[model samples]
Target: MTMGLPHGLDGTVEGREYLTFRIAQEEYGIDILKVREIRRYEAPTRIARTPAFIKGVVNLRGTIVPIVDLRMKLHQDCRPVYSEFTVVVILNLLDRVVGIVVDSVSDVLRLSDEQISDVPEFEGAIEVDSIEGLGTVGDRMLILLDIEKLMSNVDMGLVAADA
Candidate 1:
């Protein structure tokens, strides 16, 4: 299901499902369609010269997938203790497979167009462009992200140069 379409989308992002996960104290969401699978946290084979946020690579059924810590990339101060709750969200982005380390996955939430709101344009550690919108559910607010855009940018270095 569609997660974050551009803010000006014509109310068509309704009834979309998003995979919610926690990073620090904030909750974030990704399009369920991009999710390949969720695996328990594992120390990947360290790669030299890679960015500190890039946790390295892992062999997944013969395919080498690069892992990125979402918290570290976002500059969050949360303790990254790998445990049963910690997970690596495997995502298939633009035909490339990449994994993201998240604190804990919450649930698959269905959000309507009205439930999402545009984020004010402002520069931040993470690009404001990467944020799809903010979603509300009861008392919880989920920060919906444009996973494709975020992971395809120059900093992510996961997708191809022109992807």
Candidate 2:
């Protein structure tokens, strides 16, 4: 079950098939197929009256994209951005492109299907529905993100039309 990007970029890439990033102290990953590119942190144009979780919007090569603060979205404490504390991951979902702000990007990682495990039910502030699974890498655990659910769960029209 391989997913294909709009421009024909295979969801899986050689050497690395997953785009790994960080939110707070936890590691997370999304299928590379959903990722368009990664950019250094940039201040977005703030849109008044939008949700706080939606940081704002940014211009990417002439395309206006919404930017969501992962920290705030995850209900974590907001903090000042440091030189290495912020990154924008460009995502392509349902032919629409958007940018999400993360605490930092780690590295691309490749994991076999066997290496990925279903997330055990746990009580927490983080929404379990957005998690695809959990992948183990040595001593670390990577939370696999269900990009489709995350994107679809939000009202795209609201974000697209406003902030």
Candidate 3:
């Protein structure tokens, strides 16, 4: 991991590492530094009255961590079966730990300034304000996400609104 202004800042993006994951037909990436570990899909304990996307909690080495399904949260058609590709990405956000279920995790990419582009305004879950930017690697375009913002967004219902 090299250096880039904290969340898609400046005109340049350099050497920052990102962990890529797939949800629905789209590909997304998040900062590798925030990731704690990756675990296989395990049926988490259900907590009543929470949003469907909030898949409840799991015990990771005795620490209970909330699990959120990115696929369901973003309104994507989920697979009826949880296969080997299904994974839970454990992330540490603002000192609190949480897990996000994703279709599959690809690889860690190191991008330079030229490989990245600023986020353009879009009307959807993957939008300018919620994303870090677009990263280009080879012929593939990766939607780099500002995971912190996406997780903390009002619609996500993970954190309380400041209103």
TM-score of each prediction: 0.87, 0.80, 0.84
lDDT of each: 0.88, 0.76, 0.83
Candidate 1 segments whose C-alpha is farther than 4 A from its true place: 1-14, 76-79
Question: Which lDDT value does model 3 have at 100?
Answer: 94
Per-residue lDDT for 103-139 in model 1, tens only? 9999999887888999987877778988999999889
Query: In the order shown, what is each candidate's alpha-carbon RMSD?
Result: 4.8, 6.4, 4.9
Indicate which candidate wins on TM-score: 1
Order of candidates by lDDT, top first? Answer: 1, 3, 2
Q: Which regions in candidate 2 have their CA more than 4 angstroms from the true location?
A: 1-16, 155-163
Please give the distance, in angstroms, between residue 66's alpha carbon in candidate 1 and its true position after superposition.
0.3
Please give me the total number of clashing residue pairs in predicted model 1.
0
Better of 1 and 2 by TM-score: 1
Better of 1 and 2 by lDDT: 1
Which tens-of-lDDT digit does each residue in 73-163 have in candidate 2? 6655666464665888999877688788888888877777667899899987566898988988789899898776666665434323222
lDDT of 3 by residue, 84-153 (tens): 8999999988667889999999999888767899987668745467788899988889998888878887
lDDT (C-alpha) at residue 50 in model 1: 88
Model 1 TM-score is 0.87
Model 1: residue 140 alpha-carbon error in angstroms? 0.7
Summing lDDT over every window of 10 consecutive residues in candidate 2, give the lowest-scoring window.
1-10
